[model samples]
Target: MTEKKNAAAIRGPSDHTIRDQIVAAAMEYFSHYGFEKTTVSDLARSIGFSKAYIYKFFGSKQEIGEVICASCLADITERLNAALEKSPSATEKIRQLFQTLAVAGCELFFRERRLYDIAAASSREHWPAAVQYEAALRERVLAILLEGRTAGEFERKTPLDETAMAVYLVLRPLADPLQLQISLDTAGEDANQLAALVLRSLTP
Candidate 1:
């Protein structure tokens, strides 16, 4: 246990506050720098603590990582809401959804994505808040699609839940920054045409 201190555990001055302080610092570090480069001691140094202080709060680096992952989940939920504020029309809201997703896939949000993917790959059955966060995101988007339907902006015959999920699946891969930059640039030539592909399919 003591060896962990020297190995790279973060230890802070206070027994109670250090843990949360370390976790908060760790969250920002991992979010900005990514998982590969972030170290336990790095987080400790940020909060005026030593490596052992961190281990006292979280048993292992993996444990610390779990907390960061939860933060990422929360971030995704917030990003979607933030994106909605940028637009007024239901049609425009859909575009904002993709734009926000693209931003979320960038360097800023990539750290959380890395953890989300890791948990998904390792524990398919349970991923704690990470999975719930995704489900909640899906629901947010579905609600928007349903709103469009109510306004006669979307296809009326197609079931709102099924169509929203289908569109999410098709657009998920395009959420990548590389794909976004390319598709959005191309989409400019057509004006929401990227969404049109999914929309038409849902309607037809």
Candidate 2:
């Protein structure tokens, strides 16, 4: 009943604009004050909106965080796709994938530390945005493996799904927002070495 009401509240004629404004303001506020420190009331005041009005658009602070997290993850995905497109082969695509993710993770960690915290929280909590990001990333790895096999560049004996899962797991530390922070110092080197190891194993 309450969930239904909230869903209905989020779908009015002005909902899109209002919701985007609230989220945009929340992003800036949270980026400066930190997501953990900012409350709905604080965001409301900063954005010149009543707390109740803000709630009409977002069920909770976490919901707002979800939008911001999704946007950030989308940007990372865009960079990864762009890097892969520039690669000459599936082997190069796999290498670029790891390198792009590592570099993007490090950039976010240092340049947008507070926004990164929201992403870390989303990852830790298994928010829908984070879950979707992981699924898409796995699909990308699976696609790359399939491409390599078809090109006669990789072994076809191993099950593609299993191989993709293994590759995703190998890259998880660098790809995971929380884990990336812990391994920041060595993440780039780790990504390069792991990519090489994975490429060697994938060879026919």
Candidate 3:
């Protein structure tokens, strides 16, 4: 086994902590320099560690990006879960979700846009973390849909999973920087119109 892996095996508690340090450093580099331009060497130098040492925890730059993006996804999931506890109608919850994404998501993913490239790259690479993140997103949507269906707020004719996936896809572009940039002025109107359409479709 690799020395770093061997060391991690010996110190189980510290293993994940040390890896988090590397991920934190990589996020800084990725923020300053787009993911395509940030090299493993840059990340190593930033943390005062050898490139080989960084590899002990992360196999590649893509893995670092994947992990970081996954964390972001997880954070989003937590917020959504917290909102779910308020027991809002599923339609209202979904409407609030789209509004939040249209505004906050655009601001973070487009206006700030530092880590946007990493997310896009992760999607392109088809990394497992990227896939997991998407599944998590779909799951969130699914939860909302199932809740609405159970409450009789939504059409029973539609399949829950497929409807959830459709909702995710429909709202995805509003959060996409490229799409937002192309038609910035109309994004708000577009988001509202789309949300209305989706919510209308959900009503029985």
lDDT of each: 0.58, 0.87, 0.70
Best of the two (2, 3) by lDDT: 2
- Clashes by residue pair, model 2: none
lDDT, candidate 2, 1-204, per-residue tens? 011122323443465777778878988998799999999999999989899887776778988888788888888988998899999899999899999999999999899899999999989999878888898889899999999999999999999999999999998988999898998999899999999999999989
| Model 2 per-residue lDDT at 140 | 92
**How should the candidates be ordered by lDDT, best one leading?**
2, 3, 1
Better of 1 and 3 by TM-score: 3
Deviation from truth (RMSD, Å), model 1: 8.0
- Worst ten in a row by lDDT for model 2: 1-10
For candidate 2, what is the TM-score?
A: 0.92
Give lDDT for model 1: 0.58
Candidate 1, poorest ten consecutive residues by summed lDDT: 1-10
- Cα lDDT tens digits, model 3, 28-124, are 8778888899889988998999998877776677767766766655555555556656646888888766665556545557643678666566666
State the number of backbone clashes in model 2.
0
- Please give the TM-score that candidate 3 achieves against the real structure: 0.79
Q: Residue by residue across 146-200, what tens digits does model 1's lDDT show? A: 7777777777776677877887766655443334444443533233455667656
Span of 10 residues, lowest total lDDT, candidate 3: 1-10
